[model samples]
Target: MALQRKDQDILNAMSLVESTKGELQKLRDNGWDSLMNKVSSFCEKHNAEMLVMEDVFVDPRKPRRKTNITNLHHYKVNCFYTILDLQLQEFNDRFTEVNTDLLICMASLSPLDSFCEFDKEKLVKLVKFYPDDFSYGETLCFEQHLDIYIDNVRRDERFKNLKSLGDLSCLMVKTQKHLAHPLVYRLLKMVLTLPVATASVERCFSAMKLVKTTTRNRIGDQFLSDCLVCYIEKELLDSVTNEKVIERFQMLNERRVVL
Candidate 1:
């Protein structure tokens, strides 16, 4: 849900990532008893038989073998801990130390809260990662520009109400500050184009799942593509009238009767 925010919340990405990891760890450490209690309550409410944790748990697939593991051991160790470990592993793989550092540096460039997160050193460090984009002299120039840009933007009334990096970029161009501070604007443009906005991409995948369900699994590529476009861009779809849709369908082929 945090990833679904329009603001992107880049400034809090690092903290969010860290806190998520912490929560997962906490769950793995002490969540078993709490989980069991919930399961107990659910089973009781449903009038379902509860398993005795102390009872021997036999492997259903290998009943011939002598199995001595308790139901508690099978559920807690094989299922709960294993699932949490896999989740932690995936999280570690996705958000490496380098990725975390880059996100933190990117957050420093956020224009939200009147550029409260603005940091010259971090921005300079961020540019270093894209050596192809910023040469040594250009990097030094960007570092210098940060000093002037942050000071001017923070004091400028136009920038005070900025809610996002996109807003900041447009305001920079609108106020002709981009011309004076081309490098800073260039960095802002770079930041805007970064794939750090995974929320939108995640949302696209989610929309795809809704558009292409099990019943529609065999749908043609073109039809699925059209469905996804309408599903994902609902705001644009809302503007389209039913008459306009019928007109478009009529235009596509000669029907038995034209409406």
Candidate 2:
């Protein structure tokens, strides 16, 4: 049964690759030959065979033009989605296999990182999910009187013997007290505890607000999205420079003038 399940898994993975043939071909044509070799090597290492149908051997006629923008876009989107799907699957598999105790520790420590967005409800749900591995009162709070929760836990004799939890609680209390500015302390606590390390979400929102304000209230959603992307990703926007912006503005002005 185990071998059969493994074979089925392999078949499913192969099906995913087969379904993305157009994408694979585009990658091959666009100097992504290394990616094609990696995919082939992955299949070979896993003892999987590509079951190519008759239609797979036939290539459709290429467009007469030297450039193929539509095909390029389609290929890029397909490849991106396929890779993202595989990564998410692997992440889910690994998450499910994590030890409950370690997961609790992660939950406890996660809030200290600057990148970790604190969600008390999610943490409560996580605690409930692994009740046997973690006691509800074991959590030490960094702010908003979380120390009270820790105090309540420490008062219980049953938890007093757990040196690690006691030590962590003590350290948290010391850190909270010594950190002078409350805001800085909170941010530092978040940075130290959470697994997330980046402020990209905050940065994105900042950029979005800069682009989409009351002055541009009438902007279309698609245009707003493009603007946000261009603003947030400066390297991509470099190709569409001041000249392009001026040209677009002039075109719009001419159209309005004629109307």
Using TM-score as the measure, which candidate wins?
A: 1
lDDT of the candidates, in the order given: 0.85, 0.47
Query: Candidate 1 lDDT, tens digit per residue, 1-259?
Result: 7856765566576678789899999999999999999999999999999999999998889988877789999999999999999999988998888777777787887777888788888888888988998888998778778888889888888888887778888888999999988888888788777655488877888888888899988999999988889888888899999999999989998889997
Model 2 lDDT tens row, 57-164: 222465453433344344445565466556555544543333322343334423222213234444444444445544455433324344444344345444334333
Worst 10 residues of 2 by lDDT: 2-11
lDDT of the structure predicted as candidate 1: 0.85
True lDDT of residue 184, candidate 2: 24
